[model samples]
Target: MSVAHLIGKAGKPYTVEVEKCHIRQFAQAIGDTNPLYSDEEFAKKTVHGGIIAPPTFPIAMSEESDEDLDLGLEYSRMLHGEQRFIYTRPIRPGDVLTCQLKVTDVYEREGKNGTMEFIVMDTEMTDAAGAHVVTSRTNIIYRSVSANA
Candidate 1:
């Protein structure tokens, strides 16, 4: 199946109330020992005046069900190409975040082995008050296993 057909497709909307534990757990999962994500006392002393989620913590909150973002390609043969995040402000506890995902682009280019397909998707996040919080762009690469074999 051609990934081009997926361009313009929209995914399920994801929302979550970011909590202190959520930030701390995300930091721990990524092995980030930053006090801003864990030590409330220390974070309170910082310029933020409170603890905050890691820059990439939104990834944990952006969830898409099977009904969305199904590229109809070989799942095992796919690879994450890249991830970029732009943040307006630090995500802190008590903030509710909502994300809308969409397939922004798809293209093909020659790889070391052969032609490869690239799928580009984006998630725009907003706070409960409808303020833009962050925007993430994700790139996924897919290749056929038959070619590798």
Candidate 2:
């Protein structure tokens, strides 16, 4: 099955409630000790006015079920190629975000080892007030098994 036909396919929307503890944990796990991510008092003095999640914290927000939209790539041959995020505003504790994933583009290219299929997707995160918060673009590459072997 050609996954090229799956472009524009979107998965079910999921919501994630931002929590102070989760934000702090993610910051700590990433070796970041920024006050904005942990100290409410310190953050209160900042423009954000409260604790906010780190920039990369949205990486932790995801839908567990990708079964809704399958690309039909060999699981073992798939690799994460790249990821980029565009944020409208910083994520803050107590914010409820709705996220939806869609396949934006699909293409193929010849690589050093073989022909690889690149699957590009965009996940848009919107706040409870129906405002865009961030959009994360993910590129997934699948190398041809026959060419590699």
Candidate 3:
């Protein structure tokens, strides 16, 4: 069966409160030594007014779940193709955000080996006031069984 029917399928939305520690840890893990993500005093001196998360901090804030939408993909044949994030404003500690993922597109393409299926989705994040914050688009590539042979 094709995954075309899941184009608009969305998962359960979950809330997460951005925290100082998590942001700081994520920065450190990614080898980012920017003071804006660690030093509150330094961050206070900057335009952001306080410590702010790094551009990729939302990845740490999001949770993976199969609550509602399931692609029914073969785990062994799946490969992460691409990921891009769009942000309206910088994320700071104490900000509460709700995130939900929905399938946007599903298509098949002829690869060098054989046919590959691409699943595209977007994870949208919104603040407590229902303002859009960030949108993370992810693409997953699945190798068809015939391609393996």
Candidate 4:
């Protein structure tokens, strides 16, 4: 989306039921050996009282619907620049989480090869009870590459 139109746009929400299996897979993929992420019984005894996803678990949440921003940039040109997450509560299994994504910032810079466009998006996540759970900000950079190159 164009920065002029996207800035201050309310986040469009995407909801999903956090599954135990998904959490296990994500933890395993990240090489996290924390018992709370994989062992249900172990997690049950912890303070959380149940299996909870990792702090970076939001990365596993797929887009709920096609609300993709039409940035007029090629997919091949995109690169993940940075990510940060702030959590108010741990994500436990069976929690129906809703994350709303909104364009936060857009800017341009000159990279080693060419001009690069940066798009920053923030995802605000909440539990089914509407309690704030996590806020994640991701920056994606798009490199301008000529067709000849």
Model 1's TM-score against the true structure: 0.87
Local lDDT at 148 for model 4:
20
Q: For this target, which candidate reaches the highest lDDT against the unseen true structure?
A: 3
Candidate 2: give its CA RMSD in angstroms.
1.9
Question: Which stretches of model 2 miss by more than 4 angstroms?
Answer: 63-68
What does candidate 4's lDDT look like per residue over 9-81, in tens digits?
6545778888888888888988999998888789889998878888888876635534765545577867899
Best by TM-score: 3
Candidate 3 error regions (>4 Å): 64-68
lDDT string for model 1 (1-149, tens) is: 66788888887776778888878888898999989888889999999898888988877767533345565677777889899998898888999887889889899998777888898888988999999998888888888555658
Error of 3 at 3 (Å): 1.9
- Global lDDT scores for all candidate models: 0.83, 0.83, 0.85, 0.78
On lDDT, the stronger of 3 and 4 is 3
* lDDT for 66 (candidate 3): 35
Residue 133 lDDT (model 1): 90
lDDT of 3 at 132: 92
Cα shift from native, residue 149, model 3 (Å): 5.1
lDDT of 3 by residue, 24-50 (tens): 889989999999999999999999999
Select the stronger candidate by TM-score from 1 and 4: 1
TM-score (all chains, Cα) for each model: 0.87, 0.89, 0.90, 0.80
Q: Pairing residues by index, what is the TM-score of model 2?
A: 0.89
Q: Give the Å error, residue 65, model 3.
A: 4.8
lDDT of 3: 0.85
